[model samples]
Target: MSVAKLVDRENQENGGKDWIVEEFLAFSDDNRFDCSDVLFPQPYFELSNAFVSQDNKVSLKHLHKFLKKWYKDLAGVPWHDTHKADGGYYRYWSFEAACSVILLEINDDKELYDYLYYPKDLIAFYHSFNPTAGEENLLNKYNRIAIKAGEKAPQSGYWFTVASNNSRQYFNAGEILPEIKKQDWGEVYWQFEKEE
Candidate 1:
């Protein structure tokens, strides 16, 4: 089941506690998890949401509660990507996995680390499937390139270039630019082409 449905079902199973239910609704409606901003109102409420109650104090208490159940979900094989013969929505499992980690408690750093894919893996994954290299594809790759990262990531934003199969030379996601940065094997990075 989708995370939103699971959260809602659990809330129903627990009976209504006004505050708790309201908080869960608040999180479920939040823009952070809205994978498709285009689908407003109803669609936003049904998918891509999970309840961990990240607001203010007692977050860890809440995190512990979720960690208890998250393992069961994590242990299962991920919902892999699927393509439809007709022009329906394409499933991007790698991005979904990344989303799941970003919305978590970071309990076991190692386990959380395993949830996200490296830039190269994501690159190759998408590249293998792309049929038309168009504006949307560029935008998608641009968005992915920003979030795609290593396990022990340095900082938290987009870095346009990644070491493709080649050495010191890195490739931009859309072939529009060249990015060169100082990565001390596994530390400090600034931009497409900068060093410090």
Candidate 2:
């Protein structure tokens, strides 16, 4: 259910470019999730689009404006539930801001340094290592194990289908993999790449 909402959110936000979201939409029987209650500010999308533009100055201006507005309305946002007794686990976290900082490589932004929701430690942890290299290493270390779409996964780990773009996903042991509807590669087969 959560995966469905995530797919809807990403699809609305960025045309569903994320691989994980695409994978969920492809395999899940129930792919629809109600997001009518969700509150997505327009500025968030605008700020995201600004990053894709060639103008850094415009992007920075958008970032600054967004940060100011976001901080000003922090307590009013839907995810801001920290004041409630049972809200600790559901407390607001500025994931979007953290991602923006990382994507933009904005190391010297003083405003972000003081922002309460900015995940400095998380961003630092992300910057500490190259995760793509780690994934490549994992792929190289494991033997490529191929299985048909209807076959159950022999081991629980990450797998990729050569038939579709952004088809890499995780599967549990005994879970049946899915085939692409379009069959772009002439029958989908999943190839094992790594273990959880």
Candidate 3:
């Protein structure tokens, strides 16, 4: 079954809560829905709209209670991304057999809810695209060069030059420009030129 349908079915089984149910769907909606790589007997999936309610708080408590009952050695996942818990979002994480479970809720209504499993094999995908400050510094220097070239030419294509080996290497800046704007070194690395 499709993940959305699976989620909707699970929601029905757990007593549906109000939200944009048909609007936004599962993260893997575009791909296959398999139980082997993820947690089975799927949990609740929601999108919190920041609607505050004592009932919602009770719901959050129940979700946590369920997780505690199921998993062991529960610990908070140290996330760097901006998540406003005080604004009414809560997060919980736990692990077993190199697979991790993440439970998240946003606002009192629990605007965004996700129960995701991070398998050991998938860690490389995240590592490939998470940027570092040192990489950002390097990009900044190259960005300046790219922007200067863009200003001078005012063309529709890459017109940048990198000084190297007493020579210049002309590279297409189109691919890397967006990563530069976002200051994302991981993307830059992913698209970096590979030696033949």
**TM-score, one value per model:** 0.21, 0.45, 0.22
Report lDDT (Cα) of residue 113, candidate 1: 32
Which has the higher TM-score value, candidate number 1 or candidate number 2? Answer: 2
Query: 2 or 3, which is superior by lDDT?
Result: 2
**What's every prediction's RMSD, in angstroms?**
18.3, 11.5, 16.4
lDDT of 2 by residue, 35-129 (tens): 21213454454455446556666666677666666745555655555455563555445667766666666665555666666677887777676
Clashes of 1: 1
Off by over 4 Å in 1: 1-55, 78-196
Q: Write the per-residue lDDT of candidate 3 for residues 1-196, one digit (tens) a residue.
A: 3445446563445213323232233332434222212123223221122122335555455445444343332223344222544443343332321121122222332221233432323333433466689988777655432232222322234332332222222344343332223333222212122122
lDDT of 3: 0.33
| Native-to-model Cα distance after best TM-score fit, residue 183 in candidate 2, in Å | 28
Model 3: residues >4 Å from true position, as ranges? Answer: 1-39, 42-55, 72-170, 173-189, 192-196
Per-residue CA lDDT of candidate 1, range 1-196, in tens?
2344445453455223233334334445553221223222222222123333444224433333344444234343343222334455444333433233334422332332332231235434543565566866666554432322332323333344444433233444443233334565443222333221
TM-score pick, better of 1 and 3? 3
